[model samples]
Target: MTANPRGPNAVDRHVGSRIRLRRQLLNLSQEKLGEELGVTFQQVQKYERGTNRVGAGRLWNLARVLDVPVSFFYDGVNEGAGQPGFSEGDQTPIVDDFIQSADGVALAQAFARIKDSKVRRRILELVRTLAAEEAEATATEAAS
Candidate 1:
């Protein structure tokens, strides 16, 4: 396939996002990850943004440093017939973006620690309600 003139292709972007997610999950900074990989932090940023394509060897090193298999980078990628990006039905990109954030990670960690299923369900309902209310308020304000 021809290189995308606009930038890295979908697969690269997906891989970069996964790299970022794994790094964040381990509470590792881009600088720290870069140090481990013997690259500059800016290079790490490029990798995470998909501005740079990672080679096979580099990807293997990343997997080792991140404590995940190389396949983890392609976990959410869709390989439908000729399609080379995320599947239409997948909400992984959005969810991944959220989970990569500090608040999202914090909330997820805290929620996961709750052993009571009922309490967890209640918390989920509460969050859903709050989100619904916020959406409604935003819609109302937009219509005004």
Candidate 2:
């Protein structure tokens, strides 16, 4: 796992990366997602960068617009890497490979206004935990 402090902050970046990946998977454009969400592309960029915190309401709207589950954004986050982040075995190519595309960043920006700390932190823990577990499972499969 990465040596960097693993907490809410890292979780934000991971969320951003996942949003970007999903966007790519659906072949949607930043402008398009923004248009559907009734926001500018710049705002979406902020959301995907973790610069913006998505709120419960906005996340719902985004999920609806993107035709995905709200939980989708929280997917791939690992719970084991608490505040300290990834440990030795937890670190892997897949974790580092997650990247936030430009559009994904913009998408993230739209939800940047979520000011509730508790909600953000809770979401972070849940996503990170799931992500880490998935990564570990994948690694084990490959090794076997």
Candidate 3:
């Protein structure tokens, strides 16, 4: 079956998100990725936004450029329940969404480069403390 002309299918959106995720993980800009795929950066944007469906051959090319198997795009996609990349039992989507952002990707990359294990632990503790404080503040605001 074909998807609607105006909007992408769920599978297409899932694949696009996966593409964006992998591209960010590799620190590749949309233009660079588009160059590798022989497409314009605008086209890449469309693909990443799920405004366009990737064909089989194009997906194969993308897999090669991204250094991931084609199946990577479909890893979390659910075909049965009419939802793509969302499973009833899965709980980490919010985290995934955050990590998919440029700032989040940069943070992860910088954190990964830290050589000192102790420093990494300290940083983790600091972030946890900050998160706890923010949660408490939010709760207080909600109650007041």
Candidate 4:
């Protein structure tokens, strides 16, 4: 089993993305995370980009520091990917995408700070309504 020299493996990328997501969710900067890991910011960037593969011990350390289990990084990995009969699917990780974006993060932070449960439910309903309307508008535009 040989890895491609062009880029990181799928599993490595997934693990790195999970690390990045957790770090972002905690509002920790790359430098802060690097400091905790005793590594430079650039090294942390590399790790998050999957340019460097994380070793088992380092991954465990990351899990400890991030307050997640080591298995968090491997949460969505296909059981038999890179095998003869199994192929990796092209599904976008929507939660990771949302977590990685500034607007999404800001929205989440603001929503979390709204301490009232009724207000939170109302906000959720509003967002759902807006999304449904937007989707309908897009479909109508496409049909025109």
Candidate 5:
């Protein structure tokens, strides 16, 4: 079946998000990925934004270039109710959105380079604390 007329469907968006996330994690620019795929960077942007649907062969090529299994693109998809999309309660999209951002990618890469498990745990705790404090401040402001 074809996607919705309005735009790419949920599955397409999810797959595109995965592609973008993997590309960023590997520190590859859209231009670089496009070169590897023999496509222009604008084409890569369309794929990343789900403005264009990826063909099966293209998906296979992307998997190979990204050094991941083909199934990676469908990793967090929900197959419930005979529909292919993310569930309302699924956190994958939220996490993917964060990890797709510039700051998120930088933070993730820096964190990954830390070899000490205890240090990693401590960093996680610190981030959690900071987030909680920020949330509290936001709530206080909202109450004002």
Candidate 6:
């Protein structure tokens, strides 16, 4: 967004995009999300636009309201986002990649199901391990 002076501004945009995306994915209006988070729709709008920082306390409330893990916001913004001199190569993020995949949508739906708490936890663990193994296999095959 026009070179954000290199600070939390960058992270803000990422988190903001995530908040907006997740909110939209759940079909939640800003007013609804604001009510859940004890804020105003204007506040939600500002947060989603990255015009204001999301504090940890508010973030926790957001996680509960959004029914997401707090790490969800930081998932895509890793070392890749910490480029010393940002370039077009670093423009795309893990979150962006995740959102582009049909698997991501399927995963979200699966998460929405699993009424059993233990089953949900097990499914997450299993899927993570399987995805890791599959990715490793693909990388190895590529190298070969």
Candidate number with greatest TM-score: 1
Clashes of 6: 0
lDDT tens per residue, model 5, 1-144: 954556676677778888998998888999999999999999999999888889999999999999999999989776651254534355455666678788998998899999999999999999999999999999999999
Better of 1 and 6 by TM-score: 1
Whichever of 1 and 4 has more TM-score, that candidate is: 1
Compose the digit string of candidate 6's lDDT tens values, residues 81-134. 535465425568575766634577557776887699999889879989999999
10 residues in a row with least lDDT, candidate 2: 92-101
Per-residue CA lDDT of model 2 for 1-144, tens digit only, reads 454343336566666666667676567888988898888888888877777666688888887877889888877667753345354354534433633444544445533566788977776799789999999999999999
Off by over 4 Å in 1: 1-7, 80-93
The top-ranked prediction according to lDDT is 5
Residue range 104-142, candidate 1, lDDT tens digits: 887888999999999999999999999999999999999
Q: Which residue ranges in model 2 land beyond 4 Å of their true spot? A: 1-8, 80-144
Alpha-carbon shift of residue 130 in model 4 (angstroms): 1.5
lDDT of each: 0.85, 0.69, 0.85, 0.84, 0.86, 0.79
Candidate 3 residues 39-79, lDDT tens each? 99999999998889899999999999999999998887664
Steric clash count of candidate 4:
0
Candidate 6 local distance difference test against the native: 0.79
Q: Which pairs clash in model 5?
A: none
Poorest stretch of ten by lDDT in candidate 6: 80-89
Superposed model 3: Cα runs more than 4 Å off: 1-7, 79-92
lDDT minimum window of 10 residues, candidate 1 = 81-90
Residue 116 error for model 5, in Å? Answer: 2.0
